[model samples]
Target: MYISNVTIKNYRGFNNLKIKLSKLTVIIGENDTGKTNFLRALSLPLSNNSLDYNQKRLSVPDINSNCIKIFYKSIIEDEDQEIQLKKIPKVSVTIQFKDVKDFYETEIVHKWLTDADGEPCYEIRYDYKPKNDLDLLLNVKDMLKDCNASEESKWFTLPVEHYEYQIISSNNEKQISFNDLKHVVINTIPAERDDFSDSNSMKANNILTKLLVNTLDDSEKNNINSAYTEFFAAIEKTDTFKKILSSDADFENLKDYINQIECIPNLPNLRNILSNITLGYGDDFLYQKGLGERNLVFIFLLFAFYKSTQKSFNLCCIEEPESHLSINNLKLATDFIYKSVNKSNRLLQTILTTHNPTVINKLKINNVVAFNGTEAISLTDVSQNLLDYLRKRPNFDILKLLFADKVILVEGPSEEMLINTFIQTKVNSLNNVEVISIGHKGYKTFLDIWLRINKNNSAKKIGVVRDFDNQQKAKEDHDVYDAENENIVVRTTKEYTLEDDFVRAGDNCKILSELFGTEIDYDTVAQSMKANKTGGMLKICDAMLSPDKTFDLVLPSHIMEIVEKLK
Candidate 1:
């Protein structure tokens, strides 16, 4: 089953909100930003509210008990306007099952605790008065009557029991859990503290136990070690895994145990003993490994566990995947996650949070989700050209001025020359100013790279510019080009040669190009613009612009004309 959407109201810091979650949703926010609260709400099973706290494991029991109430909504209809039209104040959730078994079991169960007047319990807290409570009681009673009578009323008022499914944990100050209300498994990786042991199996256990599901005999008191041992055996066959865990007596026992279960192949080699084997490092063996290696282990372990469980759809949420990795290693991690999700033709959603711009640049544009405050902004909204410029010029920091801004993206040299001149002379006081060159290459490659970079960072001002070529076409057909338009700003130039028009029309390229002289050819003019002394671009432009014959050689006016146009 896949979770499509979640609507939360008056839950924790979220007063009233709706979010359409992606398969891989990377919830991003600073500390105390309510991201955890959002996770807890989604992780709750539809039947959770009806059960007493002690009846089952709540992924976030403290939250379930402490928060007065919570609301959940999901898009149920594939193409039903009635469902879409039904908006806020009415909450709903829908889950789509891949198998017939799940489809039959899927149901919408709502949980609400309201006063007689229909006001939610928490809402009444702020404006609790004798009159308000009386009115609320009446409203809730009417709502309850409607629920009892309506055919579509699968909704459950609070203090009602349905099913038990959710996991919550309190280790240190950090809390973690998995709720089934929206079919999302939320895992809050615990941060290490001074009192924590070097190899605290907290996070690893929480995740593996759920992933193993039936395979893990949780009814036993010592299933943790056995579960981990099984998970390790599942992936140990691959050579990549063996190098991480050498031969050991305990490993042999775990492998023998796994062989008995038939989930993994038996390995009788002296080296193939333990299931969960890790390289030992100084005093703190667990913390000593490089972050990249650790991240790799984490991702591989996750996939292995999921594969072992045979779950077709998985929503994998990770935080700061790049926390301790180098750029190269980060790239590897990215590839692994992408490949794993897309492999076996199964649907696996991987969502992660990061502040690293380079990582954003490497991802597919649409896959990148950027966050500012609590808002999840879409990067696809930016123009393709602008995205291209930022990708090529990765060092350029444009995050501060991307939104509500005017951005100009151009190809190198000629396009830059023409547009800079035009903007300076034609466009008056551009509100938020930004200019970028995606490179002199074809517009398609430029657009592709740009979108990839900008897609993940929504706060980038993006635009595109392409050459007229010989056809004098702003945007043309190129079989070699891949990016298709609707996102470019095309500009046509009439010239025999690609570089000719701008080179000929300048004081350098700017001045004459600005005039748009009919007879000028930039290539012809550029030849004469070269400076005799310094042999540099600025000098060449200055010499052409100068009135006096400063240079020893006397070049013709047409030759000096292009250089003079440059700014």
Candidate 2:
């Protein structure tokens, strides 16, 4: 079974967040946006750890409610025996917490429902309460009543304040011990993973140790122990050991004091010794490698172990995999994760949270989830054709566009390069604003994508800067020419293009001659500019911003307007 969707309410920063998950989901957002919380929610249900439904886990805005609910939609195989018996196509698990008037009454309620393919299915509810002295008295009274020999059955009542597990199912409701659902395993690689730490080294060792231990049967273990005993006995008979004992005075004294001592080996002891041995390259241990390489190795090692031990279903949730990784390593790690999940023989699902642009750029856009502090917007909600168009563009960094506080969409590299310089000079910083070049056409398609994203995240400010080309017909047909949206600003040049606007705003001859490394007349420069707009604009913008040059250069009012909008 794989989780198809998750809903979290009043947990951490999420008031009510629901998101559809994929086989490989990549979550990206700013810090403290609940990216980690989302991962925790997914693992909480399947994990063996107890839930602490305290003030810290409650959303501050809804603290008075004192309830947190996490719901999951798990897609199960229809042919599975358990699913067939339950007569359902999917499984739904709901974990809820309710804070009663007294702290003693606080309890966790686990509810399981089977999705009967559009029909009503069975629902099972398990309520777990804390244990106390009051529970013991109620148990004795209930036992007496069951025997039907109670003289004061009316005088004794079942206590409400007690540890209890009551399972209410469609067939019957009764008190039963807590039982976990089968065939589900959830593992999480938290955000604070440290590869060089001693604890992390032991964790890696433990994973390998567990895998090795589980793979060997009793017969194999016995064979290993017998081999170890023979090896030890052979070592004792070797001339090297005899020579050392005969030559060393200390050995003779120890042997005299001990009378007799023998080196014996067991399977467990040998396994322990081997588990403590670190794998390395030549003289350097694995932990001694570079941080990024060590992290990658650790992840792959753990993943291999996890895959080997899989039962029926597994979920691997990793947070901030970009941590301690360089851009090249980040790309490699993402590719590795993607391929691992897509392996034909592996029944594995992966959820990754990352902030690296290289990682985001390498993933399928449809699998990306952008968290905006309170809500999550998946790129799958976008038109597939638009995403396909974006995927075809090899240079576009969509993460920058999605995560930036404000975005400036230009036409091509020349505008993208020049506008970045212009904005840096005007604003003294480009930290909050991102400049993206979308080429000349497809402005509307790109704008629509941003518009959908903006609808979900209202805090983003987007500005589109394009040229009018001085064609009346083109101006009339420009989709965003005079368009206005709440969070989006569109600005177009007043002249034929950016080149014509530059010529109109300042001295064309002086700018062109200084930029192109030649003295050319105004008509000659204009002809050249028209012939090669991008090349002319690059030279023009560069010369205007050059340190050795000084001129009365006035930016077009519209260009300055878009810059201000972005600011």
Candidate 3:
């Protein structure tokens, strides 16, 4: 089962947020946009000690040092309107799990310390039912405390203190702890190395002790270490270090010599199933292994461990999977994640965080959670209306608004793109012009909107650029065009002489091949363009450069050119 949604209030960076998760959800944003804290919020539900079967009391897990602020219901009107801030070490989450087709909801609460009044620490609570519904309230904390209080009873009380789950550490016979229960609920997605801090080693060890039986077996571990040492020594003997080692194997030259052999500091012990193994090496050896290989090994280990699990994880939290991986490798990593989930017997829900645009673009738009500094916004917000409209209507261009501004309707994307480039690069300050391709039928539709709306100063200025298909028909076009309309203009190119099907400008084609005999092979470029399966010539920017960089270059160019011509 996977968590379907999360809602946050008065948390770090978010005043209020409610987000629905997809099977594969990706969070993307700039630095300091609270993306990391968002992950912490999700972890809060499971972080509660009551869920830990082990009764060891510890501070709430501080993924980050910044504490969340809380407020009680206020009495005064002004105080109620204003934020009544309290140092909230306590946080709560409402976790909803899906089985078959139905949803089950539960609450997990965490607290940092006792309140100022010396009262029981205020814990965050996720109400399962709507406030107005008025049903029997279920308090997870009370249920857990009750279970811990009674041992002889069939129901085991959840513990009220923090400790790793007893069941997790290799002993199959141990009674389940609250910690084990929490871990089971949270383990929807396999944990990636990037998701945790250096303390991750400790956490990982604890997790593996429970999941991988061999990890807790002393005999198995020792035997694996011995085998690993032998394997390493044999591999080293084939290296340059081996030549140095044999020469220096001389009984330390008595007291005068130290061990001069340089070999890999340590190799991963293979005895433990995938998750429990580590490949530690000296800094010198790190350079010998490429970053790609390091990431590959890291992912392979996770993949192995994930495959080894008998039970499926409910949620997997991965941070920046694109790190140290190239574009090609990122795609491969994404494919691997997709395949890994599909292979699992249980429903695998993924929470992947990334800053890479390629990874962002690969996701179905609805699955993306975009952070805008303070909060995470879904693509659904922008596309909601379009998505609704499309249920009955097929073949609708939802992104038609992309060129909806004071549109300068043109023949096609190639022409629109070229005009945009020319306006921005050659023309100065064309703020009012928006270049759009109207694709014949769309041209008439846009023309009507332009005529009806351009009367007001706020309305967009409109222009039409078309091929003068035949010189004789040009008079009809010129006659219909009211020169008196200041908001609109029409332009035609004479290079084609009205006989040619298309315009032949400066370098014979819209895309220049040989710039003044430089011989750039424009045909090869055209072939490359064809290979890129996107809509129009404008997509060339996306193919050749990054989204941010391409948009930065094109928008101002078009605006400045139109502004310059209008002035």
RMSD to the hidden true structure, all candidates: 16.7, 13.1, 16.9
Question: In model 1, where is the ten-residue run with the lowest total lDDT?
Answer: 121-130
Over 21-54, each residue of candidate 3 has an lDDT whose tens digit, in order, gives 7667887665676777677566544432211222
lDDT of 2 at 401: 77
In terms of lDDT, which candidate is stronger, 1 or 3? 3
Which pairs clash inside model 2?
A: none
- Span of 10 residues, lowest total lDDT, candidate 3: 68-77
> What stretches of model 1 exceed 4 Å from their correct place?
8-41, 44-184, 188-284, 290-293, 302-314, 344-349, 353-406, 413-466, 470-506, 509-523, 527-567
Per-model TM values vs. the true structure: 0.44, 0.71, 0.45
Q: What is the lDDT of residue 192 in candidate 2?
A: 69
Candidate 2 ranges beyond 4 A from true positions: 48-113, 116-179, 196-201, 216-222, 229-274, 326-328, 344-346, 427-431, 456-458, 469-484, 506-524, 532-534
RMSD of 1: 16.7
Candidate 3: regions farther than 4 A off = 47-91, 100-180, 185-287, 379-567
